[model samples]
Target: MDAAARDAQGGLEWRVTVPEGATVKVEHEHGAVARAWAWLLACMVMVRSTVAGFAKRVWKIAVDDPRKAVHGLKVGLALALVSVVFYTRPLYDGVGGAAAIWAIMTVVVVFEYTVGGSVYKCFNRAVATASAGVLALGVHWVASKTGELEPVILSGSLFLLAAAATFSRFIPTVKARFDYGVTIFILTYSLVAVSGYRVDELAALAQQRLSTIAIGIFICLAVCVLICPVWAGQELHLLTTRNMEKLAAAVEGCVEDYFAEEPARPAQVKSDGYKCVLNSKASEDAQANLARWEPAHGQFGFRHPYSHYAKIGAAMRGCAYCVEALNSCVGAEVQAPEHVKRLLCDVCTRVGTQCARVLREASSSVATMVSSKTLDFAVADMNTAVHELQGEMRTLPSMLTVKLAETTSLMDTMPLFTVASLLVEISARIDGVIDAADALATLANFKQVDNDDDDKKRETEMKVHPLNESDTDDEASPENQITKV
Candidate 1:
């Protein structure tokens, strides 16, 4: 019946006919919503203050070896699921619910895309914060439509919203964008049909629900600001950074060992380089865990601040190993100086190919990150430089080919100095690129957030009401201050 009313012109006419002194707080969210904002701030501070370690770990991992860190998303996501389950009390309390969240997040994600962000690309906060706003609006709309509260409608709406969110998981990240406003619209319908709340009371309701809304924001922000940085710094200085130094030492040692009077074979060098790459990858993972996942203080979140810094330190090591592997491939001739072998050539080709691929992926991640941001000044310079380095990665094959040909000119001469020199150069270049990108990203972290505390998770109205865009757009812009309840 409510759906029919939404379809028909007069269905919701009564909502607009407010009494002389009825409450409406939309036009002035800040006027009465400041109290709710404080609560939200408190919640955010408390949660972030608590989860310092988790955020640190996530940052560490992202920097150390983003490729490996990406692979571990399943574990991160699983833990997130567990956390979500533990927080279900908010749902029964009528403060929050899952489907409502999904609808909101979906709308935010889509809105970001419309405004030039690529969904699921680089700007994680935009997606996350936007989602929060979406959920708030969706829930509020539903409450307005219904004349009385009906858990069933909200519940069903939640189920549908969840389905939509789940579907979003499978979207081709590089393809067309999706907006989940449809789900929010549906939730709004559910709430309005049974929420005993009149359409006109939405502003007041948003104000009334301030406590719940503030709490959630506080939770997310606290995790980011209070905990992860310090521990993450140490983790990088120790594990990842230390491990990289060792990998460098090992590369040099292995090359010398393979060549000493004993006449080592290409196989030994190849195997050793492979081992270093694998270890480098693992270290990157562990470091990211410490940096990106760990919250600053609390043990509740998945981030491990220390781990993220360690990952960056470790990735730097991996860059070193790539150089070593390339060296070992080229150096096998001089070290073994004995056995008739074409084996080292094969090793060089393989190592170079693999290292090139890694750099390519690394470059792509940066580009994607750039595309996701509304403001690029924070990272533009770094992005441009690293982009060039990433490009240099592809140039490795040419350099190697020229060196190999030069070695061949000797007609049985092993390219010892030539390979070593090239390996070192490649390693240095790649590492330099990764380092610059990491540092720039670190600086941008502080700038990611806009100053406004109340992030309006506005819904993308698929079907616009008679209300003009001006009438409906009340969310915060970066320039304006918002006090959402």
Candidate 2:
């Protein structure tokens, strides 16, 4: 009986231990499988998110400027045209397979967004390739006659020419206009010089390369100019005009913000307008450089005053700097008394308004390519306001000295004074902008504004908003009437 009970208990214990072990093993396997599935899901989600983000960015880029898409299409078209050389047996036989590759390479390197940029690159590539080929052939001939000294002559000539071309890039004019050409000169010369040592048919090789490259350049130029051509000169002109408008908005915003009854929120100030002007030097220089390469197009002549755009940009930037300073003053912690601000408010508003008017007129002149006869009147009005501002400034010291003697420190008044001074400086800089615009008009032969048309426009405006008796009296005022030249 005792032995039977012990065996029964042992069996039960064995059964319990085996099943428990098996359950634990099963659970472990299930956990691992779940974990593997979770990891895969996470990876799939990440990949999906990444792809969505990439697509969003690409869409944004395409939408923001459809020109980019057009440019891409143009490039694709050029590549396809050049690829025809490879597919055609007769053409391939003429240039050979290796030379045909040069055409494809030329399209890739020489195609640019603007017609000016494309022309610049194409001309540079063609000239550099031809010049290098001719010179390399000459060197090859000379080296061939030198017998054992052939290698030495070729190496020395390559070294000197490459060094000279590289050094020429440091020149300001060369660096600005012909830097790409110089770079191509170095590349072509080096390749030809080095290859000539091993290649027996050097002349034929050079000729094939030149012809193939010319074919590529012609295709690129034709595509760039003939299909939705973007002229750098027109772009530069528009950019200058837009910048002037931005500057005007900034000037007006700055003045209004400074004199507001309540201090302006940071978001209320239109700083981006002026900030753009500050950052546009690089774009201006690049566009101007490219514009020089563009031929006559639209209203622009072959010798259109693209350089004057630079001068206008410079003048606009000078005003922007002053506006920046005024902005700082407006946002300063030191506050001037309300009454003190009121003292200068009328004259300051006049000055700011007149300054902005002058900028707008100048901008309009550039945009329309029409010389404004009334621009002189606007400048004179701005000057008169500036004089009024100076008079107001002259009176501020005594008024502040008396009124603020017991109430506030002199440091508190400095912000207002600084703002006033900046406005004056900005007005002076605006004169520079006017002069630059005038210079552009003269050089570009901008159409003169017709006095009769102006008179008719004014008459139409008066008829639309007929002047009251008081308005007529104001217009008759000696201070209000401006002599039109």
Candidate 3:
């Protein structure tokens, strides 16, 4: 799920590149050495896990909580130690299989860094990885039994798997579908190795490589878990929070399209209702600000839990409802010929406004508190949280656009304004939090520097007068004092 990064369009997520670099190369190369490679790589890993560490470091930097970086680094180092001790044992002993495993581990760490969102975290990653490992093991067994890793067959299987993964989400639950899809891809890859396309030796070699891969996973898993202590979730939370803003921005783009188009009667449109509002496609003009939910990149959000993704998911759902309503009401009558019917503006005044208010409350809920409350709790304090009680709150402008669009569509007349003003309000609201966060982070940084400077100044004075002895005025008064510096 973390692999599902955002495409340039930013609508849905896509796969991210594996962060393979010097460390991964060196790890694999070291593993390949005749002997003592593990020790050598251990002394100095092939790769320094920079790419792997980038996301976390960036998150901390953004939140002005660099101190967390130290803890993260410590955890990473410990995981590395564990990996070196466990997975690299066979290689260190005689197999001299160090390089490939090291490379894979580095790759895994990089994947961890790049991954984002709750679906990835929905099921524990350890569980996912262990399951994937078992799957890989199983696939390898199948290959051994079948004596076939056919290119055509594997390719077809992969295609079907991808297609199925995407479409199957319509049934059962989204989380299960996503996890199953992930397992499919993972198992498919595992089967490739086990299918004996080449021979048993290759399978044997693959098995060894797989074991080494497991070592890297252990390190990555351990390291990933350790970051929470350092930043206290401040940094990672902000990163996802920014991603949420982007999602809101995406929602706004649709609303803007509604406004930018021709204005007409609010009531005489030809559509059925507000269902069209949920259209995932944004206008072609929105080049810069189009992609909404881009947070699905690598291990970016893996440090946190699923709650972050829930916000994004909520936003998406809100968008969906807005779209559905739009389909039903797009191009509807704004002014009644016989009587004054409630227009889109009224909905804006009520639902969207209410959502904004709820979102605002949600945003402010945390600025005053410092408890171990869940992120969902913080989200509940927002205006959109009105949906919590009613099953659907509409702080989003697109939803209004969708409804208005549907109304006008049905009536065969465009409204004076199909777009709602709430998008700007939502954007403003999100920006408000972002601005406050930036300011707070800056202030935090400044205070940290100030304190560090004060500590240093104190330290300098300590060096000049390091003695901890209690001062006594009675020690011969002025005669006891030394005049020398």
TM-score of each: 0.31, 0.86, 0.32
- List, residue by residue over 46-125, the lDDT tens digit for candidate 3: 34566558876788685795545565565457455655544556555533355344434433333333122221332333
| Cα-based RMSD of candidate 3 | 27.4
lDDT digits (tens) for residues 1-485 of candidate 1: 57777768665645555457655565356556887889899999999977997888878978996644543443343335434523677552454343334322422233210111211221343343345445645665664467465455566666776666657656754122333333433444344434555444654454433433333333333332332223432333344333433444444445444444554554553335335445555545433433443334433233323333444544555566555555455344343233322334323332333234334434443333332122221122223323333444455445546655555433343344355345445545555645654563564342244434222321212112122112211221212212332
Question: What is candidate 1's CA lDDT for residue 285?
Answer: 46
Candidate 1: global Cα-lDDT?
A: 0.42
RMSD of each: 32.7, 5.7, 27.4
Q: Where in model 3 is the C-alpha error above 4 Å?
A: 1-91, 94-96, 99-210, 227-485
Give the clash count for model 1. 91
CA error at residue 380 for candidate 1, angstroms: 29
| Preferred candidate (TM-score higher): 1 or 2 | 2
lDDT leaderboard ranking: 2, 1, 3
For model 1, give the 10-residue run with minimal summed lDDT. 112-121
- Candidates' lDDT values, in order? 0.42, 0.83, 0.39
